[model samples]
Target: MSEPWIPIVMRRDGDRLIMEWSDGFKGAVTWKALRDACPCAGCKEEREKPADPFRILKPNELVPLAPNAMPRVGRYAYKIVWSDGHDSGIFTLAHLRELCKPLE
Candidate 1:
């Protein structure tokens, strides 16, 4: 099989995460978008569930969305440590590439 595409450069700039792929593609995604698109099983379940329009959010739920840190996982993914205390998502490079908008 051919080698996977690698993210050679990754950095957080203001509200977006910027990345440059081994294939020369450059992209960026907002922190909120990244967090909302988290691929963890728990997150997937939450997203798949129907929204309750009448439910009131707790104060903690109002916390601003942001990435506190992004730690690499083995050889394929990164775990995003979010400001709201969620850190379960392991976003692979391929997933991240798809999530990002191509930089012109």
Candidate 2:
């Protein structure tokens, strides 16, 4: 397989992950987004179902309950240990790269 778009630097900044890509793109991804978009089977199941939009929380209450842990999976992917005890997502480097917002 061809080389992946790996981050040259990956670090945590409060409730977000700060990543600098090999192509010089740098961005921060919030823990909430990461958790909500978790690519694990359980999370995918949760996503496939319809959501009850009535349960919107205040901004303060919407924050991540705990810090996240991201462990590298060899040189191909990163495993996300979510704050709420969800830890089955093995996000690939390409997926992570796709999540990046262009630095304006």
Candidate 3:
């Protein structure tokens, strides 16, 4: 099997998460996309549910996509703490790499 793609650098730049892999891949993803792609069970379920046509945003539901912190989980992942108060997803290196687009 091929070796895992390791992250060489990870950082938040405003609303984007910038990453560089050990294999020379560099990319960035918006904070909103990262939050939406949360891999926690609850978020996963929520994403799987059909979209509600009448969904309305309440005042408190206006969540900011900014990450308050991204702490390393062992050697393979990061646990993101979002500004919206949700902090359960542990994003693996491979998952994160897939979420980003090549930086122009």
Candidate 4:
């Protein structure tokens, strides 16, 4: 299979992470979801709980990240900077590709 297009540009403003793919598609990933799915060990462990998979994050919780503090992950991913100052959640190029996939 062909490699998915990489994000040529990444930007974070407030509570959103915006990416521009090489194919010219743009995506806006929310900080709340990203934070809830942060790939860090702590977040991963928290997600493993059966009783409350997302208890660390309340259903209505929303974290707005600051813009201009996003980190690049080896040119293929980005570490989002959340409004809560959380600089985790490594968003990979492949992950973004999946998000843009059309649902059947």
CA lDDT of each candidate?
Answer: 0.90, 0.77, 0.89, 0.66
Task: List runs of model 3 lying over 4 Å from the truth.
Answer: none
Which is superior by TM-score, 1 or 4? 1
**TM-score, cand. 2 vs. native:** 0.79
The CA lDDT at 97 in model 4 is 64
Q: How close is each model in CA RMSD to the real structure?
A: 1.2, 3.2, 1.5, 4.6
Best candidate, TM-score: 1
lDDT of 3 by residue, 1-104 (tens): 88799888888788899999999999999988998899999999999999999999866568566888999999889999987778999999889999999998
lDDT of 1 by residue, 10-83 (tens): 98888899999999999999998998899999999999999989989988678768888899998989999988
Tens-place lDDT digits, model 4, residues 1-104: 88769877766545566768788887776655666667887778868867765557643344333434567788678776655555757878787666543322
Higher-scoring candidate on TM-score, 1 or 3: 1
Minimum summed lDDT over a 10-residue window in model 4 is located at: 59-68
lDDT of 4: 0.66
Error of 1 at 29 (Å): 0.9
The 10-residue segment of model 3 with minimum total lDDT is 57-66
Best by lDDT: 1
Assess every candidate by TM-score.
0.92, 0.79, 0.89, 0.63
> How far does residue 57 in candidate 2 sit from its true spot (Å)?
9.3
Q: Residues 3-88, candidate 2, lDDT per residue (tens digit)?
A: 76679998887767788988789987777777777799988997898986897875755655544678889888899876666678
| Range of the 10 consecutive residues with the lowest summed lDDT in candidate 2 | 58-67
